[model samples]
Target chain A: MTGDGAPRTLFGKVWDAHTVDTRDDGAALLYIDRHLVHEVTSPQAFEGLRQSGRRVRRPGLTTATMDHNVPTGDRSLPMADDTSAAQMRALERNCAEFGIELHGMGSASQGIVHVIGPELGLTLPGSTIVCGDSHTATHGAFGALAMGIGTSEVEHVLATQALWLERPEEMLVRMDGSLGSSRAITPKDAILSVIREIGPAGARGAAIEYAGSAISEMSMEGRMTVCNMSIEAGARAGMVAPDEKTFAHVRDRPRTPRNIDALVESWRETLFTDAGAERDREHAIDVSRIAPQVSWGTDPGMTCDITEAIPTPAEFSRGDESRRAAAERALEYIGLEAGTPMEDVRPDRVFVGSCTNARLGDLREAAAAVRGRRVADGVRAMVVPGSQEVKRLAEAEGLDRDFVGAGFEWRESGCSMCLGMNEDVLGPGERCASTSNRNFEGRQGARGRTHLMSPVMAAAAAIAGHLVDVRGWELAEAV
Target chain B: MRGVATKYERDNIDTDVIIPGTYLKVHDHAELARHAMEGIDPDFHSRMEGRSILVAGRNFGCGSSREHAPIALAGCGVRAVLAPSFARIFYRNCVDGAYLLPVEVGQEAYESISDGDELEVDMAARRVRNLTRGEEHEIAPVPEIISGIIEAGGLFRYRVPE
Candidate 1:
């Protein structure tokens, strides 16, 4: 709330800071500061260069890691799966051949591509970043216009440090009021609830800036969780302006300016759009109304409060008939029925990791939810930390013990179970409550049904053997 | 091309569904194309032998910024994708890669174009001629700049004019 529209938003300030030139087409030729790469998408771009006989143009702006296909548990062993092994080796060979820095297995920095960027301070406020991974939007938490690029575009960026981007229509989604204690709302819940209210395409072609009292109060990690899933709602990206929390998180990390006053001043100047700034669309939500949300169908927008029932296709608006059909197909595939209470939807497995919700805070929340409560009998539960550093921190805080004690497999850091590239995958026909981004059919593994939920909700589901209201349990103790 | 259109109508047909994230690791465009739509429709690769265009509802290519999406479609011989809308990244990726041409038509256009309709796409004129219905519908042509990219055979080749 900057008084009478004098308030600058993070989006405006950051966009202005990074804009190199406005083309005749009204698109921006923005310079990217940091470019993250992973095994899955970088190989082709590198091969394209090899065929053309060109070297990586700017290795300084780029960094690479292997996450999408690396086995979660046995880093020492050769990848057990041929596809995973080949992808990992290809990234290693590509990075080596191109002279790009790579964080391989057993490295402290090795983890999900999105997790490592911010942790290493490579993703900074008022900067543009791109990766070949969709969750590249996760970096927008620092008020950067971070986005995912295609393999061809990755080569373009590798050759030229800048990208041609059409400026997206801007939207502001402001939240007010402290979340009610009984709501058990996390940033995951908040984002899911917002997506549920606004259909999947509600923010299409928009660069959404989240603001207001409640958003401002969240930690940098919480803000990251919110921005990470913005793409799920069909928005190009979501951002929260860099504030004291952002400054505090980045100050001690590598690459950030060591000077306190100068950093503060720079961040303050980067806050751009005023509260009343012109926007294509503006929405306001009361934080108190949100609860721990769970996706009832495939898309993130097909979400509801855990206490609610699966929506029948007939209940959908006329415009949503196709979506209703898709939902019906997804429900049928997931072995769930409409009109069943969402809380009654039991999961055979539980996963708590992804670029969307695998931060240290998410781990702590899951640990809290499972603390002193054993996982339901026959339920397969796993807690995969997002980054190596996140794993180390969790171990130092004894969070691993909480998860292990609750009968959950404490695994190494990677994008395990998020997009079944690695060894950690659900069995055929197994249904899981996951803290990942998408719940598309067989996304976790072939014939494995995924139910997207917050980490806390996943933990609650694991303990109860069903989708349960996380708020029903005492949560403060875990936090 | 002569059979009735086997329409697969769905909204938000994301790149992930068209080409899952895991297949991104494979560099061979042809091999990757074989797995296109494996998760969604297991026989998509085989079924799309000679399809000229894919008709769908809103927000096609909605997830992930993988260019493999357009490459996969192109390799599968799909010349055009006509949808009500498209995700910005996927749309740009398709254009930049010079693979698949994305045409934005109205919702009514999708409704009228039934499955198995023999169709011909004209990129220069930006129209889909519904041969079955003897009808013509205009679509948003690829921008001039993007048309140049396609003419040059993808972005890499386009950049090196020589």
Candidate 2:
């Protein structure tokens, strides 16, 4: 089905299929297959549409939810923050006026836009998905060409279901070796390590296809975690070539296509990169070498292995004085000194949630680590499920009980403490071991320090009261 | 266009720093403007007053698709941001939303442009004139599609020819 008879990468195939038209400048009008809307980004976009008096082009294709600004605690009470309440109400009203399906705050399907898209089967392989949130790339784990758009593009998509964009260059990020051998290296660690290697802008303007043995061996949830942080490396998007694991994850979900079997067969035939296709850049990472990564500074790239010491400004700064200055500033803000061991830095809190790691698998891993253990004294910890559905499933399996039994707060679902748009925020100067993505300055709260890690690592940090490595952690009886 | 520059000579000035996540729920342009660069510089709103050009290091606006970032900067009267490079989504949002200009300059220009340097950005000539320092620098030529969209005033006004 490759039109030009040239071997095409999966990105090329998906992008080409969705091309509505192309201009001379190589800018293509891409038909969007899915549009995921969240409260924080959609308000202005909806307002723009309302101002223009335009109805949604394809209401059925658009799905809305209240996530970013929705409070994760006590759904029964009225939202205390008026601005957040207004925004949530705006989303509800806008969805109603536009006739778009909204998974409201209390709806079973309501959760992080990225999490619910996959859980409900709205995200399909070989599709083009766009959301106003940067982490929309999380859906690329399904092998879709997913990218984040801005509010303006949100309105544009609302009106036309298409937007003009120059084709992104392709990059092949191949992960070789065996993740199975690296027992403590979760997909979160693998991605953090990739970001460390590439720096923040490493994959700028490129859509990355994650290939090689390790990526193939990962579960769908793991793939989602890896793809979720592609934006952190400044990549336009990140994806994996859909395999049987992808199909199995999508099968019989609430929103999957009716002809699932035939679709799977077709996907099996054409969803992968063709032989001999070229990419603008290629980098191979050995998964076995990746340890549990923890971001030590403001940006995700400012990371180190669990066993490594904090990097000095001179060591990490590649001759750029500005980079060194930034590193110095980050250290000052993070309240850490160079050469300090990661394990020695104590955490004030532990958060196991966000679109990146609040899935059922992630919770199961975290719960296992915390099983029969209590959260260290003075270290507040919480586990928020990725979605209500994930919460339901976790509770059904007694995962919630394990977390509660371990003294971790089992809260409701949303993007809780990820960006801290909701009530689950870190106090100023509080350091947290978090399973979410992005350790940017004030990402969780003003002056809040976030150390990005895997769910198990966060759980262990809760138990140990410090940023301890999760490997070989011994779980004794709860005190 | 001409204005004085307010430079933050550092890389990776992220959106969360531009407009902190706490204020994301408020869509008012003016409200967002008040908190522009709140995370990194609490005095940014005051410091940015009367300045239309913002110069910074590499990878400016490096996190989030909040668009609130460009919206906040633009709301604070920033007409153009000159940096070595910009994050992909932030760059597009700046251009596509017609919020502000994201001008990519070489490292020399990015460094040489000083804070409070009165400057003129000539898009047609593809040059930046440092009026205060009396130096001229070439900026990356805006791509054809981008120029076309800008001329037409953002994506909504510019119709892509089929």
Provide C-alpha RMSD values for all models, in order: 3.1, 1.8
Residue pair clashes in candidate 2: none
Best by DockQ: 2
> After superposing candidate 2, which stretches have Cα over 4 Å from the reference?
A181-183, A475-479
> Candidate 2, residues A179-237: lDDT per residue as tens digits?
77434678888888889999999998789999988898899999999999999999999
Worst lDDT run of 10 residues, candidate 2 chain B, spans B141-150
TM-score, model 2 to reference: 0.98
lDDT score, residue A330, model 2? Answer: 96
Q: Model 1, range B84-120, lDDT digits (tens) per residue? A: 8898788878878777777788788788898779777
Kindly list the per-residue Cα lDDT of model 1 for residues A1-479, writing each as its tens digit.
22343545566666655777665555666777888988877777787788878777789889998788777886677667897788788888888888889988768889999998889878877778889877777888888888877888888888777776777788888878766544268878888888878877888878888888888878788888888888887788788888878877777776565675686786676554655567788888887777778888877888888888988876754466887688778788878888999988888999999898888988988888888899998799999999999999999999999999989999888888998877777788998999999887667887788888888889989999999988778864643
- For model 1, the docking class works out as medium
Off by over 4 Å in 1: A1-9, A181-183, A258-261, A476-479, B1-6, B141-148, B157-162
